[model samples]
Target chain A: MSWLLDNFTLVTELALQHARLSAVPIVVGLLASISLGWLAHRVRAARLIVLTSFSLIFTVPSLALFVLLPLVLNTRVLDERNVIAAMSLYAIATMLRGAVDGFDHLSPGVTRSATALGYSPTGLFWKVQLPLAGPVLLANLRVVSASTVSLVSVGALIGKGGLGYLFTNGFQRNHPTEIVVGIVAVLLLALSFDVVLVLVGRAALPWIRNLGGTSPT
Target chain B: MIEFVGVTKTYDGGAPAVDNFSLRLAPRRITALVGSSGCGKTTLLRMINRMVDPTVGRVEIDGEDIAGRRPVGLRRGIGYVPQDSGLLPHRRVIDNISVVPLLNGATRAAARLRASELMAVVGLDPALAHRYPAQLSGGQRQRVAVARALAGNPNILLMDEPFGAVDPIVRADLQQETLRLQHELRKTIVLVTHDIDEAFLLGDEVVVLRPGAQVAQHGTPADILADPADSFVAAFIGSARGKRRLTISAQRSVDGADRVVVDAGGYPVGVIAAPEGRLPVADPTPRSRGAQVVG
Candidate 1:
């Protein structure tokens, strides 16, 4: 307990750095996934290809993906950027899956009705499809965010900044308190992001709450 | 006015859904396309607004061929309502209704104002405008869909089984509401349904399609009942002709003399005269023997 109180400031700083690392990659990954997913949906023939490629990327072992990035990019001295890249790759897989799921989840009747109502393809995607996909998109965001928070630890192997750094440092120094603090902080961050996502979904997408009160998967 | 000139649609690797169909939908009148499942009634309806383009022939609206026009522009001028309501789940009732107007360049406020008026036009309570589709009942959702179709105030409205997902009572109410709207608005309408009774009730001209999307018959309800083009239509009209006859008889009243009182069984229970001031009691037995009317 004394150990915890003494290193509270150091732990808090590490936690913040970890959150930033997770957040940056998640944001980038989400944007890319949504854009790519929407493109795949608009082009009927590209759906299978886009989905398969993303699925394959997701199947690659996380450690292997991170390890290979430096080799592929022809760079050494893995730093914060390596952490971001590794976390972002992980997030891309989840977000792409989520975006595809959101697109497929839309009722065909709605698309038909939109077309019948004279909505152009663009209008239908923007006004009908995207808005309808909100809950699913938000849920995807939560999953990706949680995954990034946990996976950011892979950065410690390459000497990057985050709570993962604290874990590695504590392991080398034989301090269990630092490792426990890092693990607990990450779990709390993931849970908090999930709760915040739910609240945002409920507030911004009241239809989701009204539709059987089941959050999007 | 909408004209279909030999329109044919063949799904990929499948038989033609609509086979060289040709028909005209007169302005300000309701035309019902009735057929069995996969009979291409829906495919035919979609061609009116170019939701599904014809592979062989052309569809015209207001005497202009819609082939060269951008499908989006063409659709913007035609109101479409489909079965299952098809309201955007995330949008409030009012926003859903305003979709077309917004597409047509109406300001958000203007479109919203029009949407509210349409909500009333379709017989929905004004308070429902703020509710999302998920919050509404099936019947209410269908009403909202109708209201949305009317938002652009287009001269042509196409509905494909718009009331199919609702209960019978709600379906009847929606049909009545559609008729009332037609009376007030006088837009050209084409509706598709599998139910012949619905076609009779709603259509000024009923076109019956066969299994492969061939047109079996096209005529007024009275004419179709009096003389069906073939046995397919006869069977399709079902054994409920007696009830349909009563409805037709009631609608055809001149000087209010066609008095027909039908029981819940749809059999004539009594006959009375109002414009002729004659009240006569007919046989109360159900008319199960023949198609002829007894006075």
Candidate 2:
């Protein structure tokens, strides 16, 4: 704790980097997941292929992936791109499942109603199907973001991770306080992102507030 | 001005869903298609808006073949009320009601105004406009669906089992509201239902269909009831249809009350005799609204 105060600037900077590193993968993964999910929903065989491939990709150990990504992408072992690339794979793996589940949870009769009402295909997809999918997608955002935050700490094993460096550094220098600070910081960051995602979801969809006023999470 | 001339539909080389169906529906009148499940009652209704196309014949609206019209354009002018209300659960009541008009190019303000007006017209309170469908009771949601269907002031309304989801009391209320709306608006309505009583009560003409979509009988309620075409029609009306077998005599009320008596299934049996032949109560069918009981 004393070392953390002594190097508060260092801690804050690394924490910011950690947040950025985690957030990038989540954003990239969300876009890719949405596209894949849409395709899977429309194509009969795409769901099977996507689910199987994503499951296999997710099973790659994080340490191995962090090391293996640099070789695959032709980057340096210490370059931050290596960590981001690996974390994005994890993020996409997580979010694809969430997106598929969200789509499945849609109200059954809404599609039939929209068609009978004469909604154009584009209009139905954007105005009705996508907006109605807000709750499920929001739930996915929280899960993917939190997991990404946790996994960002794992990158520190390679000396390129954000918060995980504090752990390795504190141990090398016999600074238990710094280690505690790093643990506390990562937990707090994950919690903050979860709350933020929830707030964003609520602001975008006010209709969800009246669903018994309970947490959809 | 809807005409179905020799319209037939079959799915995947199977038995015809609607076999050689032909009919003409006069403007501004309610025609009911009633039958058991798989009788193509729904298929017949769907053919109007081009949801299901005829395999062997063309359907015409106002002397124009609907096959030539774009489906989306044809559907926009025809209001549809599907079974189970089919309200969009994520949307508020007002947004659901206004969706059609908004899609049809009405400004948001104009659409919302029309939505509120329709809310009142469909017997829904204005306050419910901002509530999501999940927060509403089933009956309230059904009214919201009706409001949505009416938002565009459509010339034709296709109601597919519109009142099938509600309880008996709410069903009665909705039916009364529908009748009042029909009388006031005079829009052409095609109501599809399996309930024979609902068909008799609401339809200007009822078309009965068999399992294969063959027309069993087609006529007014009085026409079918007064003289059944065959035993199949008679049994379809009711198993204990004693009116065709027994003669009903008017007897004085035992309690000396001015009322008509009925047998078990609500058939009018006799009326209380007027004192000293002043005249028995004239009619048994309650002409007032919402007096509907099982036939």
Candidate 3:
């Protein structure tokens, strides 16, 4: 109890760090994925190839990805950037798949109608397609974000700062209280982020709630 | 006028969907392409807007070969309504209706205003402008789709089973809406449907396509009903003629002696003369009245 009081500020700082690390990757992955997914949808022949490649990337083990990042980026320097790069790679796979699924699931009639309406392909993507895909993409963001919170701990192995550092220090020092606190903090952070995403999804895309099973036509 | 000269479309390594199809569509008229599934009626319709390019021949719109124009540009001047209302679920009803005008470079505010006007034309309340597509009923969605198609005020409209997804009651309402729009807009419309009754009701000119995109018959509804080119057309249209004839005859009635025969409800249905005085049957054989009195 006395130790908890002594390290309260330190724990909070670690929690904040962990959150920032998770957030940066999720945002970057989401934006990149949406753009790439739209490009894949436009090019008819490339859809399967792009999806398959992303799926392959997702299959790679998370730890291995983190360990290998320093080599790929050509930096012996192991820091926050490496942590972000590894988590983002994992996030990209999930996000890309989500964006692709969202777009593909849209009614083909919408595309046909837009085309007939004289919408340039670009106009159609931004106005008709992306807005319709909003809810699904945001739901995907929640999943990827939660997973990212847990994965960032692996960055601690490279001496980066986050809750993972707390967990590592607890283990090295054999302090069960610190380990429990670190784990709890990560869970709370993930849960809070998820709730925020749901609220954002509802506010940004209210249509998803009313999208009943009966699709148009 | 729209003309298709020996248009043939063959999918890779597959049999031709449309083979040597040739026909002309008169301006400001409603022409229906009727056929069984896989008969390539849709393929032929797609050719007109260059959605599908013909493999063997040319499609001309207003006497100009459409081959030279970019497909995206060509599609802009043509309205297309699919079986599904195809409303973007996330977009408000007004935005969906404004798609064409927005695409054509109209400002957002102006496009929205036009959409509001079109909503009234399609019998939707102005209050519905802000509602998402998912919030509306099937009938309303279809009306919004029709409004969207009319956004650019195109010279031609293409419809493929536009009301096939709705309930019978809703389908009737939508059909009436289409007729009303056609009357007001006077745009050349090419509609494709497998339902013979729909073809008969909406088409100023009906072209019946047989298997492999063959044109079995092309004529006005009365002409085709009066004289079907072959057994295929006769069987197709003949089954519905009894009820159809009643509808036509009802329109021709001129007096108070003609009592409007309605169903259980008070809605004007058809005219039936008193049984005491009846026109003699041309044939002594029993004839079936194919006309069904739908409520």
Candidate 4:
């Protein structure tokens, strides 16, 4: 406990670094996934290929991806870009399936009705389809956010992990408190993210809040 | 008036859904295109708004070829009600109803005002305006659909089995409401249903279609019922069911003030007046009319 108080600024910096690392990949990956998901849905021939590729990427070990991406991108092993890029790949893979499911699970006839009611294709997607898919997308995003925060610590092995440094440093010095502090910080960050996502979801998707099955007419 | 100028629609790998079908639909009347599944009734309706364009030939609305119109612009000017109440589940009833009006460039307040009025027109309560679709009952959702269809105030309303999903009692009520609404609004309505009874009840002129979108028969309900064009029309209208054959079973008084009319299956369908001077319309039943005519 005294160690955490004494190294408070160091912990704060590491936590901030960890939050940034987790956040960038989530936001970037979400945008990419939405685009790819829409393409998968629109282009029937592309659906199987896109989904299979995303699933395959998720199967690669995270440590291997972290090592492999730097080589592919010609970046230094310790470059933060390597971690960001690799985490983004994992985020996209994790959220891609959810994006597809979100769009696929819309109640039947919704898009048909929107088209019939004079919605332009673009307008329908933004106003109706995207908004209705919000709940599912948010749920998957919460998952990605928590995992990314924890995963960023793996960067420590290659000298880039944010709070992950505490794990290796405390192990080397034989001090358990520093390791516990790192674990506690990551857990707090993930929990806060999950809490914030739930709040945003509730605010954004008001219709799903009090929904009951369609009442009998 | 709408005209299908030898329109034909063919998909990628099957027989043409609608093959060289042409028919002129009268203005301000209900024309029901009825057939069982795979009969292309829905495909025929969608061509009006360019949802599915004809592969060959063209559909014309008021002497203008619809193919020339932009699809979004064309659909905005048309009212469409699908089988399920296709209300947006995420939007409240008011927003769903106002969708077309808003698309037509009405201000938010103006569109919602129009939507509220349309809710009354479709027999929906104004109180349901703020409820989401899932919060409403099936009947209410359908009423919202009807109100939404009317939002743009389009002259032509296309219904693809509008009352198909509701219970029979609700369906009958909705059918009657459709009639009442037609009497008031007089919009040119094209309804599609697989049920011949519904077609006869609601359609001013019913077009019975066969599997390949062939026009098996088209005429007033009475004309088609009285003289079926062929065996296909007969079976479609259930002539073999003997439900339409009514007989005067018993006279109630000396003056023939009332008589019980029963169908072939012995179910009382209706009662009729048969005053003394006016001979009861000859019963089609083979049973001697005199024996049943107690008066």
Kindly list the per-residue Cα lDDT of model 2 for residues B1-295, writing each as its tens digit: 8999899999999999989988888678788888898899899888998889999988999989999999888888889999888887778899999989988999999999999999988888887788888788778888888888888889889999999988999898888888888767777889999998898888877888887678888987777777777777777766346543433335446665545656655577566555654554545342532233221
Which has the better DockQ: candidate 1, or candidate 4? Answer: 4
Give one digit per residue, the lDDT tens place, for model 4 in B1-295.
Answer: 8999998899996799999999999788889999999999999999999989999999999999999999999999999999898989889999999899899999999999999899889888788888898888777788889989999999999999999998999899888888878777788899999999999888888999998789999998888989989989888888767788788886465556777788888888887877753545654322211122211
How much is the lDDT of residue B160 in candidate 1? Answer: 88
The candidates' DockQ values read 0.54, 0.40, 0.50, 0.63
Highest-scoring model, TM-score: 4
Q: Could you estimate the TM-score for every candidate?
A: 0.87, 0.90, 0.85, 0.93
Q: Is candidate 2 or candidate 3 better by DockQ?
A: 3
Q: What are the per-residue Cα lDDT tens digits for candidate 3 across B193-275?
A: 99888998888889999988999999977788788898788778753434333331333355534545543333455666634
* CA RMSD of all predictions: 6.7, 4.4, 6.7, 6.1
lDDT of 4 at A172: 99
Highest lDDT model number: 4
- Among all windows of 10 consecutive residues in model 4 chain A, the one with the lowest summed lDDT is A208-217
- Between 1 and 2, whose DockQ is larger? 1
Q: State which candidate has the highest DockQ.
A: 4
Candidate 1, residues B142-189: lDDT per residue as tens digits? 888888888888888889898898999989988888877776777788
The TM-score obtained for chain B by all candidates, in the order given, is 0.83, 0.88, 0.84, 0.91
Displacement of residue A80 (Cα, Å) in model 2 is 2.2
Question: How high is the DockQ of candidate 3?
Answer: 0.50
Q: After superposition, how far is residue A99 of candidate 1 from its true place, in Å?
A: 2.5
Candidate 2: docking tier: acceptable
